[model samples]
Target chain A: MTAVRPPEADLVVADTAVQPSAPPVPPAATAVRPRARPRPAAPRRILMKGNEAMAEAAIRAGCDAYFGYPITPQAELLEWMARRMPEEGRAFVQAESELGAINMAYGAAAAGARVLVSSSSPGISLMAEAMSYMAGAEVPVVLINVMRGGPGLGSIGPSQADYFQAVKGHGHGDYRTPVLAPSSINEAVELVADAFELAERYRTPVMILVDGILGQAMEPVSASFRMPERRGAEWVLGGADGRPPRVVKSLHLKPEALEQHNLDLQAKFGRIEAREVRWAGERLDDADLVIVAYGTSARVARTAVARAREAGLAVGLFRPITLWPFPTAALADLAARVRGFLVVELSAGQMVEDVRLAVSGRRPVTFRGRMGGMVPTPGEVVDAIRELDGLAAGGSR
Target chain B: MERSVIFAGFGGQGILFAGKVLARAAMDEGLEVFWIPSYGPEMRGGTASSTVIIGDGPIGSPIVDQADAAVVLNPPSHAKYASHVAPGGLLVVNETLVLEPTGRTDITELRIPCTRLARDAGDDSLVSVVALGALVGRLRLVRVESARQAIRDTVGMKRPQVLAADLAAFASGYRVGSRTHGPSPDQEIVRTRVHHRVGVPR
Candidate 1:
């Protein structure tokens, strides 16, 4: 409408500038994904690695496209998709970079296709830019971050350090992507499917944030999934057919207009938070101490809870399945009754802050974490619970 | 019944494959199973290890700090994981590679010449599978037939000879394991539990 050129105009100009000598490189010029031959039939139950389970679950849920780069801990996921997508007649691209993968996902989502992209820690960081753009454009894209330790290319082991990066809006502006963390392979399968459905329901990006340990771990999963109804084609970009042109964009440059966009995003986030907070509470009815954790850490915390209970200690676990919404209300309710909280994580202390905020000075919340790819043992978590149990009745210091 | 088994050796020992076989066998028996391989540098011609947890109920943690049983194929693995085995746990050692004593008085230690047995069985690559057979055969953690089925599942049609070699290696280890030790105490409990829950024969 204004004189400002749309982002797609640059792509059009670049396309026109390309000489015939270089017949436009194939869409996925950089190493197309591997294609898998069709198998005889699906097994009723199969032993699957966590990453492969997530990929298979997404495909079973009728994911229309997959675009991803190779990253540790989640490389198997991309490999699985690369092989299976062609067989399923879905688009698959092994993008040149994490940015390229996310942008491909954005394009597919804008075209009204169910899209998925996966990467590990540093790769997820690289994808934050496109994630921001997709968020602003209100694209329903499902992303999977099989998290490894990192500030930079850290270790290729499990870590929950990306908690803030995932839940606190990694991209610019006040936008939040719903983040789901699954503690087990079966949960990963179910949650990944749910992630796609939720993304479509909210028309916002959703992330299935799992730790590297969960990604590489092989476990048995039934991997049952129901295909979500494809989203209506009203907002899709295609032939105009004499109707008004649909411009899928995120450039709200005007100050008041940007303010309105932010408000709308906030409203959507508010609805998601109110409707979609998912968590699991174990032994909380008479818990003296609660260990707050998610993903792989939550699995360890469950073991720790069992150990503590065996030792006649009143320790329980509060595992938030959805990290973005944070399950603040559930923790708040538990805080009113429990003696204290011990937030155990694989990072130095990412989710601990969320647990603290959830408590809001209502009870003591102690933090214990392992970092740089170190996984916390059940003993460590039990020790932390004991330390939290010893703390005088007061809020987190 | 929950059983945590750690398979440890150098790279190229088929440590992860052995764990996967055990995991598949456990799952086939209707038990929840988890297998986690040591990733990164430790897996590339270094001291590689994997933890497999099999249980009747849902497994809590895939990472096993202390194992209910351990199959140590090399000296470094024996040194690293021997002490981590719980009291009364099974410790299957590959005597061909690990000559030293584990120096632990708390657990059942069965030393097997894995490399020798695997070679006699027709391939050295079956060392881990041999050790796995020893572990499962001695402890009765998983049924031998189910384990063979798992071997079939994991080692499919591509390399049929390798599968045959693995089965032979497993049978040799099972014979040696059965001859060396009586059925483990845990076997009775597992048998009853499996029968009561899944109606599976022990």
Candidate 2:
């Protein structure tokens, strides 16, 4: 260890010294990195982008179909499914519009089949119409959004500006699309599968939130699943024999009927909230400072936690894979054990407010984040964590 | 441990293809692999670069802020990325394509005349393949046999003459790397504990 003795302590030692010469100091130890560690049991190993991995994961989750359009970034995912889906004897629909795509997803869902649709910024804007209809009609579909830099027609970089659009509802209605924000290519797969499971359990639409960078970035994955058994006629649409045709239309003219329909959708949302709220915690059990972050920023936050640990501070990350079904219950659960909660994100303190609301005044929830396309570094997040002791990150700078 | 290598050259020099072959070799050796191309619009026609990450464990970020080793196929590429290579990292440069030399005091730089070697092999098209051979020769990031297999897998049954030239080209490049840098001193020395990633939906 390299030590710098304080001058006061040095004076004390020198003043009291009538001492003999000390033994020779030993050489500094080289950072000892241990030898080969064993591999984890059952590792996933395929090189894929977040969007493609999410699609593959959706397929493995027994999603029988996919519908999409040609868009940069997210196009890789559609291409992947277009090649593989048919070989597995599954339906891969290149719907004309985002609306057409989600409707295909909705039609598949009404028959109790797993289905998905993916699009980028502009295309997702088109999906609002169908998504609202899906929400009102009480159908389950997995919608993947690989967000590009955007407002009207924007650049092709990654951005998280669509958080509100996804959660508050893209489709204008008194309903919500259960949203998931996956952090890595690896998590995109599993979380997308979970979205399918959650959607089915609650009978509502689910969206896998993503961005262009995450869509294009490649990573190794080893996830696998057995090909689902083929379903015959009577399972879904495009069948030879129809016992009774099912209507997927969403029109109720009666005011009472519309109110009842809204009530039913709200009931489903209640069930979703009660049943699903996903979160991940690390170093948090003994942490003096806890940070909440999600999506790609959450991965960076985890890296921050590792660095903070090395700096002799107890810092932890709470990553939400499921953004809504907001995981409020889980946040309430996490709040019971911690003193301070700091929210970090790629957005300007939007989701942090949610974490604060979930904490409900139990503990101070501070937020440190950037807006637009800026990414917070691991070092920057560590400084934020360290400052929590003196409320250095309280409210705002 | 994660190792990153950036392969850079003019677009016509098969820079992206070089990165792909490196990734294929790593995948063949059963290691975690990631290959990413430069995402900006400058990918049009000028100098191009791609980052390749290989590890025994799952790779972290696909975006590399710094690289462990680098192979510069052109002079501009050498100028752009030489400073980014970490100390003790190997830098393989193409003498034929890169005209000027920048010396790194702490890093090892290997010079291979990939284009001349491709000409020597009787084909100039195999220059990148020749560079790939040099990387295998020096880094031994994967085995020569594994790389050859990857070449075979990627090429399939193209022009037999080109196939023969590529094999010779890869072999010559591999010899250069092997003779110069030798095997990585820490070959599998720092082992990474692989974790179960995630399950795919079927």
Candidate 3:
């Protein structure tokens, strides 16, 4: 790469140097009165598929634009947007490809519009480059990955194999996308509604990761949402009427300048990791083994934990709602008291690596996973827990 | 309390629709519910199924290895799911289509001629709805009134023309299920005959 530094590099350094150190204001606390718009009054409670509910929640969250290419499991989301986005007087485009869709999202988000882009495993892989660009540019964009089995065009069945691809960074460079995993349609809706706020607050991409099961599953959800207040972003690209033109780009040919940008990204990731780790626990206080899981696997593990409890086993479930920052501190704290840990996933083992890092050999972390779209049933997980119980009781690996 | 049901049949048998109806009814009755379908590249003759879980508390694991109840509308579905029902649970089979016996006696099995009943009720496509009514009639998973309301909300809103026929089919199945009991003395004789023919131990 050529080492010629653009003159705008100084302006970029000045812009990022002043990032606020204050903790982000929670979205609900900063909300204003609902906007006056004529639309159908949301039903108090209605049954909806996870894909459809998430799409609806994005609209309620004031997503100003949507760009996506249809893919299995998540195609319904794009289809829903196609019908509803225009009804709300918003922009919706069925881009020619995932690359095009993600770039459209990048452009829309850079212009200060709340944007949503969605795809499945292979589709997401196609968008990885643009994702890196958006993260580097520090533009707010919300992405939904309704994951399916995959290394490559794997299967259209539910899979969490993208754990590494999501939390560990799918694209190049040192960057982290805040990942929210939802096990149920209701939770998916709530997370989708909040994802926009999270992205805007951090000025980075936020991913809502679900699996095909959740996307296709139907459940009762309250469509009503507290609409987030819209505010003008200072960094967005508008006409350079009286002010100097702002540059939003990821290209930095000079090594030192690129290093500075990377450091800024790392610092922003640090703040996110410190402030945005979210998890849910059940029966963890007195448990000997905590089953660590997220998304659909977590739902199955919850049932397994409950069954193990009924069988008089001291078992609990720890579900990480945010896959990254990976709930490291919280899990480390648990590792101190719990005898061992059992990690479950819909892949051979991806998140288990993170759990191992979090536990740091303090407690043995055993793993149970299924690949190629086969989900571990609650009984299977319970069986795994029984094995872990024996190992924990024996005080052996 | 938590209960789960699996609805399985050939495609176009309204397998998913039946499960949705139960889930919707459960929701209307103020219970938490989940309905997940087996989705893939399948056409009209292929196997299709959906699982619905209803609970008083938060539901975990929408898919289950063994459901509390199952409604199987075709022979292949019956062969696949008959043993998948939990012990002491209910299995509602479409008698007109499922020729083989379930070969199990631990759980109450209702073999209603759902297709015949639906045909008599003026819509053969209501087979799944009839089986659904039979399931609710035996299990009492949700009130019959609530199920009726759910049909109005789900199927009625979609295909309003068939609403009356669907309701009628549901009533016919309900009547059959209410009058039937676990392996009537006559059915026991039939089960023994079937076991002997199928070479299955009683």
Question: Which has the greatest DockQ?
Answer: 3
Worst 10 residues of 3 chain B by lDDT: B193-202
Q: Using TM-score as the measure, which candidate wins?
A: 3
Error of 1 at A162 (Å): 0.5
Per-residue lDDT of B20-72 in model 3, one digit per residue for the tens? 88888887766678899999987889889999988766678866988889999
What digit string (tens of lDDT, one per residue) describes model 2 on residues A1-397? Answer: 2121111111111111111121212212232122232244334245466666776667666778898888875787898788768766899999888778877777777776778889988889988988888877767788889987667656666677777788888877698878888666666766676677666666678898886767876765544432334334233344436366655557989999999988887887787777666666555667767878877676567656766777787776677767787878767877887778878766666787788889998888777776545567667777887777557345334
Query: What's the count of clashing pairs in each model shown?
Result: 1, 19, 0
Flag regions of model 3 displaced more than 4 Å. A1-43, B185-202
TM-score of 2: 0.77
Candidate 2 DockQ category? incorrect
Give the 10-residue window scoring lowest on summed lDDT in candidate 3 chain A. A9-18
After TM-score superposition, what is the CA distance of residue B61 in candidate 2 from its true location, in Å? 3.1
Residue by residue across B1-202, what tens digits does model 2's lDDT show? 5678898887777777778777877765666677877655565558888888876643444445557888888888899999988888878888777867666668887777777777666577667787788777776777778788778755654444466667777877776666554323432221110001111111
RMSD of each: 13.2, 14.6, 10.9
- Reference-based TM-score, model 1: 0.88
Cα DockQ of the candidate 1 complex? 0.20
Give the Å shift of residue A331 in candidate 3: 0.7
lDDT of 2: 0.69
Q: Give the Å shift of residue A381 in candidate 3.
A: 0.9
Docking quality (DockQ) of candidate 2: 0.11
Question: What digit string (tens of lDDT, one per residue) describes model 1 on residues A1-397?
Answer: 1221111111111011111112211111121111232133423456788888788888878899999999898999998888888877889999899988899899989988999999998999998888889899999999999888888999888888998899888788778999988887877877877888899999899999998899999887764554777767688887688999898889988999999999999999999989888887666767778888888887788788888877888877777888888788877877888888888888888888888888998788888888988988888888887777678344433
Q: lDDT of each prediction vs. the true structure?
A: 0.79, 0.69, 0.82
